[model samples]
Target chain A: MARTRLTPEREHELYTAVLDLLGEVGYEALTMDAVAARTRSSKATLYRQWGSKAELVVRALRNDKPVHLAEIDTGTLRGDFLAVLGRSDDCRMEKNSALLRGLSHAVHDNPDLFQALRELLIEPEMTGLQLLLERAVERGEVRPDNPALSYVPHMMIGAFAARELIDERPVDRAFLLDYAESVVFPALGV
Target chain B: MARTRLTPEREHELYTAVLDLLGEVGYEALTMDAVAARTRSSKATLYRQWGSKAELVVRALRNDKPVHLAEIDTGTLRGDFLAVLGRSDDCRMEKNSALLRGLSHAVHDNPDLFQALRELLIEPEMTGLQLLLERAVERGEVRPDNPALSYVPHMMIGAFAARELIDERPVDRAFLLDYAESVVFPALGV
Candidate 1:
């Protein structure tokens, strides 16, 4: 029998279910059977669509992102960063943080998932951030020779990863905004 | 049977074995049985000593750190930072980073593990770092009101967490020294 094609809406629903399950049980414990039950879809269809659990989870995470960094341009680096933070509300950011935390362990153990994350999630975000930095340089806001330029992604990502571990606080817009004003912007000497 | 006490050397051997197993199988797949067999100890003794796998893993990780930041003081913050980096060679840093990445995910799902990590590993590190920063402030090297002071640990830790994720690089002394000079020092205006 030919596999039924899913509508875009149906795909979104499936992804949402996957993310919900991922958040609840984590990547290690999340199962295709559970995902199928949650989404009311057959396990075969999911496997057919995503190839494996790693692919499916990565795709679901990729789809969950509402804004692409490439699409953000506010003429100033600070403005652009603020715009990026504004893309997700506090609740959504918290949920995404939990999801990412859940996947962090899985990525280390599973090479396929790490590859998928790099290709689908990390690469796009890096490209978008690079574009933003280039534009800032073109605008003479950031020095092209700044040593800190290469470390920007690391700094931003570290902020997200270390927040809960360091301060026992969630990564919220206020913290990010403050980080930008104090730590990041000064490092860039902007 | 009364639990036989392990000598300090034997305890060190056991912790080393636990860390090895953790690196091999990760936190979720790691079993007390595997640890006991690997260390030539009984499961009952393992349980009695550590109370649980979470506690055992956390203790092993804590024991792995050779340096405490509080003991690092070179009169200059930059010198102090460099001294801290010098504590771990590249190979040890790489192993530690891998262990940390593996544990990052486990900490999220297991509250008991998280609590153990906080009480044993994180709190001491944070306190040591705080002492360093306070000394810097006292020396007038950093302004007392600098907002960046509080975020120093976040930035340093973020660099460690983000290195592999962003650049596929290990957190080494060279990278950290460069990071301290370019990103961290400048942010503090020192």
Candidate 2:
């Protein structure tokens, strides 16, 4: 008999279930058994498709967090930055921060998960931001070799994420926006 | 007969043994058995004196790392940054980073270890950095309300240390100093 093909709807259900489980149980606590149970799939099915908890979760996260930042190429640097950074009034950044902690912890322990996490999830956002910076550089808004650009994003996002994970505090939108505008943008020479 | 009072020489020997064991096995791998084996000290003595691994390691690191720059009072912002950041270049910072990871992994998992490690080791360094920033603000070097100041030290230094620990890469003085001059100084102004 031919293998049963998983429809797009089925895939969506599994991936969505993975993300919901992630938010509930956290990355470290996520188990293959749990994923299989939540999605009403067999353990053998989950195991055959994704070798480990980390791989499944990382892929699920990448699929779930489709960055939908509207590409607004406002002429001015401030306009561009505000366009990118102003969305934080909705508290998505805080949710993203928690997701980052889960991802970082997952990556630290599993090399395959690390590569997938960075390549699929992190690189896209980083590339998008870098494109934003490239536009500014073209516009001559900042110095060509401003060193703060190197670690500014990681510092702002990583610091907030790390602190929240370690301290169990909320990563609020106002706080994230404040940091992006006041600290990150300034460091980047925006 | 009363237990023999440990002379300074005996204490130094014990500290060296602890550090050696720390470098080799790290915090998790380290055990009272290993420490006792390395130092040829009774495990009872270790328990009686330090109470736990956090206490023992904290005392060991403090004793081992020579106090270099604290309470930096340089007139200029650049000058002050150099003073504090320069200390990170010392050999002590190398051991310090390893010590941090060893301790961070432990404390992150166990609340008792977390409180103990924070109180004994991490708090002092954080306090020092905070005071240095406070002084800089008082002297008109940075804005009074720069919230980034709260996490700036961690952002710069912690990011570097974290990257090193995460990537298992070389973290040298020249690289860090350049980061200080570029990323750190710019972030301070805005």
Candidate 3:
């Protein structure tokens, strides 16, 4: 079905509406009618633009993530990680935590959504981090064979999940700093 | 509601039924009626015993996890981790993964269920891991104040999650061995 493209501003509005709804009711309960009512877009428009709820949510997740890595070169791998971790303020982190919690189940249920999420969000972020790690290895700040390179992103994800599930602690600047110095740097053998 | 207590064997049957149903239908779609039908237990009996579907599922998760850490003391932390990681073969790991996938969404939605899951399953396992780490520190295999102490459980959880979400890899004996040697040991500076 041919569909009219939304203007960038209109698309942003739809994405915001979907993400907010997702956080509120979760993916299972989120509906096109609700999105239409919230964003004042017609149901036909939404269905035409994005074929299904999964597609809409996937695009919203992609849009929510920062398109590129925050350009970071702090002269060392630890410095770069600290810098990147510090970039997300408490408010953003909280929002992300809630959004992620709401979407966690849906990601597992919908393989296509999960695949898209990894490709769009996880892969890009990992690639950027990989580049940052390579730079550190080049400068001899970290070993070329450090296995932490592969698992750092996973650990960071786990750290976020842990904070949410285990402690319900704030993944704020102070905590990330502690994690970087204590868990991350030592893991890197730095 | 004062409920009739089943014998240990019957309770085990119910828990198995709940977990199996959870794997088949997921938390959202799972119903008490389905569990009753599957196990051929009356709905009244189920409700009387567990109070709710959430409680039933929580008990199932608790029952599925190993109650002890397999009594591992391999003289070194690395060897101990390998022993613990190698304890579960493909089958148990597969069941745990499926059960976790089924509950991931519901855990965030239901606080009481989440609390029970942590207290019953996650905490016991972490306490056991903590003991293992302390033993390593006594043997001088790892530093007493390694930051990885606080984060190892989270990392282990992350490793499971990353395997599920990022790579879609099997969290098998080999993968855990690699993760322990690469990510876990180095993080501990062992």
Candidate 4:
């Protein structure tokens, strides 16, 4: 479907509104009417531009991502992982983590949101991570037959999900870097 | 405050209804009226017995736990980990995992719910895990100062949260056992 275009600044304003609303009310309670009201746009305009709430939210989240993991090539797995952490400061990471927790239920319930997340968000990151692992394997930093190789994404994502639950702490660059050195690197046999 | 008591069988019926409603409508959408309607009880009864939705839901979840980690001691950390997985079959595990995913947002949003979960569910489990780790430390399986020791809960819970997100697969006994052997055990140098 063809889409109407908003000016870059206007689009940024709208996406920011969507994220702020999402943070406040959560995905289950978020509505197109609210988005329209928040952005001072008509619901018709939102639907015309983004097609659905799922698409709009997913797109906003996609836009909010500061770095695409696929673009980072630090020539070493450890450096690549650290670079990903370095892209976001502690406060942003905490907010993003909260945002993700808020969306976890929505992702489980909404197939369209899950599809959009996989397509636009998860897939790109997974691909980038895979590249890093592949490079590690080629460098003999890790073995090809290591079963943990398949679980790299799980391990990384788990660090985010389990931090607050287990330790009552927000995941930060320092914690994650320490995790990478102690948990991930050792698991990979590096 | 003194609590109204229901018979064990009737209490089970009420908790089952609560969990069923929770699974169907989610925590945000779930209401005491719906719980009362489902269980054929008055809303007053639910309130009197559980005090609040968060307490009721947390209690129901606590009741639903098949294994208390503190009770499991198979002589090895690996055995203890596998035993926790063994308590729930694949289907139940998947259901519990989905229930957790459904509660993820609610846990973040509701302080009462989070508090109840930490007290009733998470604290018990963490204590049990700590016992197992302490045993390992005593056995000299893991070094006392290992930083990864602090992250064991993160890694295990991450395995649960990341399974569907990363691989589009449900977390199961086999997968968790493999994760224990590959990712977790290796990280601890066991």
Candidate 5:
């Protein structure tokens, strides 16, 4: 007999479980069975809901951002960037094992992973930063043609991944934000 | 029976093969067996020479500094940064699939990949830039206490990588240099 299909609530529950696994295992070691077992859902339900581990993880990441990236309200460009890029936040630093491992491993093996990573991980952050920079440009705080303007957000965040994955550091938010204000913003002339 | 160790002439042949493979197959897909076949050395010899992929790759990157980076002689700091970065001659921004994959993958697993990448990639260019900045400081073109001096390398190069990896475009060196001059140097109170 077929088991009753997983409801939206149940799927979200599993997604929460997936996030937990992502934190625990990193992407390389995260497996379908593990996610299923942890969530108390069958592998069949997981596959039916999200198709594969990558899809499930991407789904979870998609769900994670609205909760993680809190709204920032600092008035100055430096203040706003600092608020958004708080070094105390896990998402801001390179220490989110799941996000990095997922991006690194997923890009190599699955186009879906790459697309999803770009959409979920890269896009939201880029768009958020563009909005920030646009605001700064309007306030006349930053140059309209600042080249680092186009690239700094991505660079600041990506450097964390590069540092942890390559430099073997913990990728803490303090270190990242300090580096950003000291290096990135100054380079942007703001 | 033991086979004779590879001669220095044979070792050089093998190192060249690794470079070609690094630019061709990437770090993850490369293997000792494949390298042996490329170099016409037996797998035993390859294993005997290097224990892991990380070690082998580090050796390859450390082999020698090419004329490309050392040749930049632009009269100004901004010109020098532009000349070395985003230029086609050095393949710095080329984003060779094999090379990036290798670097990205190897760095994730090995502790030493960071040092190798720094020494092989980031440090050479940064060291040169540091010298240029020092000269500028002596000439009173820039301040000795400029905060931008501490981390511009990461800002510029990290910006380029972020543009390539996330934005999915070829990094614009001209933009980077312009950013340095218009935004970065000026903010340094130069």
Candidate 6:
């Protein structure tokens, strides 16, 4: 049977439906049938388009998220840090956090999903962040061997996870500013 | 039928079983029936002791994990920091990380579980860390109003998580020490 390819609009709808279902049911409980029912698409169509649920979810994340860090040449490292961290404000923090949390368990079980998330979803962001740091190092804003250089992503992502899991707070503008000033800046020797 | 109260040994067994199941099955799919089957305990007894799966898992974590940080007074703030962060070694890090990852999805779904985890598991550790900081302050090893003091938990926890999620590395003793020396101590002005 010939598979019906979805238009870009339909593909986006499929992605939204997949992410929403993931947030609700998690990767373990999410089934193609549920996605089909929710999107009024067929299981065959989903499978035809993406071989597995993990592939579908990974694509959805890649498509929806700002995978590449925008050219954030803010001149100062502090400015660049704020520009990057502040972008989270544009994201649906609760939904994103919930989705990550739900997928947290299943990622370990599925190597393909884990690799896709790391390579496709997370790696690009890390590259952009590192580039930003590299530019700063060139300008003598930060030292080349500063250990905090390697941990910039960790601190930011960790803080994001901590905010959701432990603090139960939103990573708002004020919070990012405080974090940059108090946490990232000091560590980076800014 | 009268419910049989579990002795300390039985309770310990139950906690171990629940935690083991949580690492294996995750919180969403974990059921009272599965727990009963795994532990060879009656579902009625399980329900009688703990109201729900959330309660069971929470109690299990509190019992199995070090809910409180021990006296980590290493005289210096850096020493105390190393002592506290170094404790991941004594834990079943892989199992604990898996258990945490599995529960990440459901923690937000169940407020009771979230509250129990934060209060019982995380808050006490935070208190111990703060005591370590206070002693450092008294000894003039750290300043009274250093902004870094407030963010110590966030930095350490964030680094731990970042190492796991982004770096795809273990928060082993060597990694923790390197992190403390390079990232943490610099931030704290030690």
State which candidate has the highest DockQ: 1
Give a tens-digit lDDT track for model 2, residues B60-149.
Answer: 877775553355678776776666566565566766776766665565566776777567655676777677777788888889887667
Question: Tens digit of lDDT per residue, candidate 6, span B15-119?
Answer: 998887887767888899999999998898888888877778888987876435656777887776666656656357666766776566577577887777787
Per-residue lDDT of candidate 5, residues B1-190 (tens digit): 6756767776677777888888787776888888878877777776677766666776665553333445676666666666665454335445343365567666666667656766666666657767777776777777788766665555554655565576576655555565566546655665
In Å, candidate 6's interface RMSD is 1.9
- Evaluated at residue A3, the lDDT of candidate 3 is 60
lDDT per residue (tens digit) for residues B1-190 in model 3: 6666799998998899888778877888899989999999999998888878777888887776653663677888877876766666778888788777656667766777777778777777777887888898899988887777788877787888788667767688787777777777888888
Residue pairs whose backbone atoms clash in candidate 6: none
- Using lDDT as the yardstick, the better of models 4 and 6 is 4
Model 5 TM-score relative to the real fold = 0.75
Residue A3 in model 4: shift from native, Å?
8.3
Better of 4 and 6 by TM-score: 4
Q: Cα lDDT for residue A150, model 6?
A: 88
Candidate with the larger TM-score of 3 and 6: 3
Q: How many pairs of residues collide in model 2?
A: 0
Error of 2 at B117 (Å): 2.4
What are the DockQ scores of the candidates, in order? 0.66, 0.42, 0.59, 0.65, 0.39, 0.51
Overall local distance difference test of candidate 3? 0.78
The TM-score obtained by model 6 is 0.76
Candidate 5 Cα errors over 4 Å, as ranges: A1-13, A43-52, A65-70, A85-99, A158-168, B1-15, B28-56, B62-65, B68-75, B82-98, B110-129, B172-190
For each model in turn, which proportion of the native inter-chain contacts is also found?
0.81, 0.33, 0.67, 0.90, 0.34, 0.69
Q: lDDT of candidate 5?
A: 0.66
lDDT of 4 by residue, A1-190 (tens): 5666899999999999999999999999999999999889999999889989988998899888878888888888888887888887989778887887667667766989988888878888888888878988998889999989988888888788777767678999898899999899999998
- List TM-score per model, in order: 0.86, 0.82, 0.83, 0.84, 0.75, 0.76
Give the per-residue lDDT of model 1 (tens digit) for A141-165: 9999999999898788778867877
Candidate 1, CAPRI quality class derived from DockQ? medium
Q: How many backbone clashes does candidate 5 have?
A: 2
TM-score of chain B of each: 0.93, 0.78, 0.85, 0.91, 0.68, 0.84
By lDDT, the best candidate is 1
lDDT tens per residue, model 3, A22-110: 88888878899999999998998898888778788888976876435646788877778667666667787778777776666677667
TM-score of 4: 0.84
Greater TM-score among 2 and 6 belongs to 2
